[model samples]
Target: MKSDIRVCASWREHHDRPVYTLTATCPACGGDAVNSAPAPYDPTDRYGEYRRALKRRARQ
Candidate 1:
């Protein structure tokens, strides 16, 4: 079995200050690391679909 992993935003604080964090995941493998760097070929991500859906709802 395979599970989809994705990089979602996280948050941390510097001495209680606001901050943002970046993380990665693999959708095909459970808890596996994902590479986000430019690939030799085209890079595809599911985030685009989410963005499009949001846009559609916003326009409604």
Candidate 2:
């Protein structure tokens, strides 16, 4: 059976620091099938990328 993998965000607090982990799972199964060793992307910079895109557009 082929299972479609879906990316999910897991948020929590560790040692007073916010931890964001990107996890992958298959609906056909149950919980996450893969837990990334390090986050694929930074949660804090979520809007930063968008802001940078806007700045680039303005400069064009």
Candidate 3:
């Protein structure tokens, strides 16, 4: 399931550490917020290239 938790995009101006929140906007600075969760896929996945190629072929 997707996470509802997010972090302020402009956290540097508001606090020394990352600020976590459940809302789309930050409560402190009213700035934009982004998902705090790590990416689900591995960066070095060996099969990723093949998967992408298959997707492109299907599209064409």
For all candidates, what are the clash counts?
4, 0, 0
Q: Which stretches of candidate 1 lie over 4 Å from their true place?
A: 1-43
Q: Over the stretch 1-60, how does candidate 3's per-residue lDDT look in tens digits?
A: 578999999898887889899999998889999999887887899999999999999999
Tens-digit lDDT track of model 2 for 1-60: 323433333222112333323435434333344443444555688698888899999999
Query: Which scores better on TM-score, 2 or 3?
Result: 3
Error of 1 at 53 (Å): 0.1
Ranking the candidates on TM-score from highest down gives: 3, 1, 2
TM-score of each: 0.28, 0.27, 0.62
- Please list the residue runs of candidate 2 whose C-alpha ends up more than 4 Å from where it truly belongs after superposition: 1-43
What is candidate 3's CA lDDT for residue 43? 87
True-vs-predicted CA distance for residue 32, candidate 1, Å: 39
Q: Following a full C-alpha superposition, what root-mean-square deviation does model 1 have from the true structure?
A: 11.7
lDDT of 1 at 3: 30
Question: Which candidate's TM-score is highest?
Answer: 3
Full-model lDDT, candidate 1: 0.41
What are the root-mean-square deviations of the candidates from the true structure over C-alphas?
11.7, 11.2, 9.7
| Per-model CA lDDT versus the true structure | 0.41, 0.46, 0.91
Task: Write the residue-wise lDDT of candidate 1 on 1-60 in tens digits.
Answer: 223332322212112332222334333232334333444432487577888899999999
Scored by lDDT, model 2 comes in at 0.46
